[model samples]
Target: MAAVTWSRARCWCPSLLQVFRLPVAKLYLGRPTMRASQQDFENAMNQVKLLKKDPGNEVKLRLYALYKQATEGPCNMPKPGVFDFVNKAKWDAWNALGSLPKETARQNYVDLVSSLSSSSEASSQGKRGADEKAQESKGILVTSEDGITKITFNRPTKKNAITFQMYQDIILALKNASTDNTVIAVFTGTGDYYCSGNDLTNFTSATGGIEEAASKGAVVLREFVNSFIDFPKPLVAVVNGPAVGISVTLLGLFDAVYASDRATFHTPFSHLGQSPEACSSYTFPKMMGSAKAAEMLLFGKKLTAREAWAQGLVTEVFPESTFETEVWTRLKTYAKLPPNAMRISKELIRKNEKEKLHAVNAEECTTLQAQWLSEECINAIMSFVSRKPKL
Candidate 1:
């Protein structure tokens, strides 16, 4: 197996700086020289797996560098090529640590993790008194009932536009569901949109230049799609309304996609000067003929629910009035199936194509990172952001 890159581990540290309200520079400069017990370091490593929020790219890079120095003593690997922006950035981050002693690096890593854990606990405690409704309204709402784990997009007001935090949340939700007692996992959104896809704010709010932003975004995206590709149980999508961009593209990975009559599927990658993601590049062409896939992905053709069903992108279309009732009724039956049998069957079906999907995901993300830094993509995103938001 290949060594896991920092990008693969990027999902581990969530909301460290934000929870503590600390500047990235200050966090590092103020690091205490106090030694931490090896047991403490091991415990911190375990705590990292439980983190559920994104702490920003700079913080992620710092954590990666410190972890590398602590474990491997130094960055001895050869630098990646320039076009391999994700690995290149990670390599540079680890290499920049110079000759820091392993013990000091371990102590620093432990301290950083401790601070993040403390701040997260403090923030949660503070929010415990806030309105429960408000808390539930933001981010993801994951519920497991009747052996079905339902992950809903709770940000209806924004048309379920996925922020960085939401992406991490969804990944965590799926991770938990995969090992749980659920027979199936479902995804849906609230309000008028199923999902409008990646929030442009994820790009705009990044502190570094486009290169850095694109690199980090690529890392997140690769892991996000991998969650779907590696999902063990039956994965279903209940398309309540309009779905665009990544949301539309990713439906190709779902075991079943039930759409409301009012739902629309669109992947306007070309308009944004981007390419297909979520393994759509391969899955679309495989499901629908190459011509139809090119029409939707390259020509930006939006499909109605019926049209999507006709093209095999959607399994079925339901009347808007009964969409939820009808879909869940069927899903409840699906949830009652023998869990082990279902998982084994799913694995057998996906096994042959799993390697292919992973390859395509990696390729798409790499291409997207380069596109994101291109003048064409930059101008397109700027123009779109400047205009009124629409689905």
Candidate 2:
């Protein structure tokens, strides 16, 4: 059998689980590479179905897309029309794979299920931690009105730097908006700056030893980026001022990105002695071409709003005085449209990248977590914190 045929056969067969200890990938030359155990994949799939709360539309579509792609190879059906929201979303998600082979899709499915299962279990064990409560007072401010959900980074005194709890809050807010049928779009912004990536103080102050803190911090950040990857609704970012670190990378995931005339964006991963986050490794190159992505990630080039717009990284730029009003007006226009239609359209646009993004996120997190423990990262953080003024 051809490699694709064999992979599809194994994916569809349950009895094969009894014979093989794990899923196997056959090389073009006929050698088998060990992958996840069949039992492991099945268990992850089952856990997904058993989870109490819905994983929201994007995740549901992702699961369906991955399952179909793994079992049936690339989509062979005709694309659905625009008005057929349900089938269109499903079709687009599956068809986005184009001609992706079966084994790769299976591996992607396995990775997604494992991540979701872990997240669900963690939620079930706790309602909300102290960190969440501590930050509830002022970190992330969420307000919804007239179909618009606005999530603002409110820690301006600290240049809108995000803490672990703030990350969790933002993820929850986004997930909540995804389920709220009335919520047509989500707008993220900040007072003086978009965000300063993360608060290094929070990371260093984490309890236990340095290694434990780094590991736990990496886990939290991974969950945050994964949530962004699966955000279902139209995410719109209003870059009111400067954005740094993950904040800059995350703009690639937004469906619409508007910026103030004074807005600036930069990712200091290379300068910080850390790897990229938020799957920017893939999304950036796709959005701005490989040459530009290399400059941003490798050289830490900062771009003004106009520069970003010219480079196709931003949708538009407006004066600081009118930026919020203009962005809200645009969001309201989208909110007035058919919610299902809007969601399906966004999904279709993002569907092709779904699996590849998850894979990249997994790889990035592993490397990032290791980097977090490195002497270079430790010294960098120490110097930044002890310096006269923060970076």
Candidate 3:
């Protein structure tokens, strides 16, 4: 359970944050400095059982001891009188595995326990207010005398849902315009949505299935985010209607994101039974707390423009009626700036934010890739692809 702890140890988040808990037994066995993620630990756990299977034997027992020593401090600092039956059972079971070097394992366990500091324990139940899905979208297009470069995902037919070709087009257009001295600033997204990100069906099929596609998507989106993270010139995105999943996540990497009043926002990954990509792991939590970010990432809930604004995650929102006009007007502001200044500013800001962004992208990729290879994730993808579209 390197990347994650056991679900049992994990706080069951009916809503909001689910605390991450580790089973006291064998918790300390892995390299603590490294976040093994849930699947990493599970894979190793399974392997241990396979190769070192002794029911109530030494491998399992040593694992248990390691877990106890590692988590000893985190579990409310191990009270002498509060020792419970579960601990006793784990101890008994652990005893079956011969004790090796307790001190050496202790350090590793402590490291594993420290990793959970990044995990939040708060829940919606304890909060004073509650809200569900909220979202917004707008179109950012610039068609002035300078140069014409429009990026629109506002295809009304599919609610502006993106196709694979659309992403390729975006990359191509951005790269081209950014490189072309003739073009000053690039316009992005249009209509009800700048984009709704990937077409899940096409994505699933193209990658052969969700499990296979997830890893691939993670890698691709990481690169995609990097492209926008620091384009030479200014970029203005018009987000209209609802922008969910990768659409919302990627927007965070943009310099300026504008949306309509009715433009809702969300990362629908969890609802879709998927993990987040597009470097959201670091961005989300850094902008929002672990609890808030986890709510979006773990639950796939949508949020309103006002809600996003409050969190400072969104810059501005316009009414639906004037969304298009507002988007262009807002973009014109950036277009008005000295093109060279805008370019340098974008680059400078990105350099400042680079480390954390890369760290998050790296973490998201690691877990996403590992999860893609799991039976649970693979099975889920098969089931999803086999199902008919909802009416």
Best by lDDT: 1
Candidate 1 weakest ten by summed lDDT: 18-27
TM-score of each: 0.67, 0.69, 0.57
Summarize candidate 3's per-residue lDDT along 1-391 as a digit string, tens digits. 1222234222321111111221222222332344444444444434332321121222233455555433342233333333453444344333422343444455543443333222133322211121111001222222234443555564666656665555555555555455344334443454545556566665456647655566666666665666665455656556666776778887667666777777777776654556887777777887888888888888866788878777767788788888778667656555556554555456556655765676777777777777766676666656755783331
RMSD to the native, candidate 1?
Answer: 13.2
Error of 3 at 251 (Å): 1.6
Instruction: Assess candidate 3 and give its TM-score to the true structure.
Output: 0.57
- Worst window of 10 by summed lDDT in candidate 2: 22-31
What are the runs in model 2 whose C-alpha is more than 4 Å off? Answer: 1-137, 388-390
- Writing each residue's lDDT as its tens digit, candidate 2 over 1-391 gives 1122233323433221112111111111111243656566677676665545444544555666767776788788888686755566567667666666666666666775665554555864433442244336478877667787778888888888888778778777766666555545464555678888888887689778778877887778777887777776678887888988988888887887888998888887876778888888888887889999998998989999998998888999999888779878877887787665666566667666777877888888899889988888888888788882544
Which is the winner by lDDT between candidate 1 and candidate 2? Answer: 1
Task: Determine the backbone clash count of candidate 2.
Answer: 0
Winner on lDDT (2 vs 3)? 2
Q: Which candidate number has the best TM-score?
A: 2
Q: What C-alpha lDDT does candidate 1 achieve relative to the native structure?
A: 0.78
The lDDT values for all models are: 0.78, 0.70, 0.53
Clash pairs for candidate 2: none
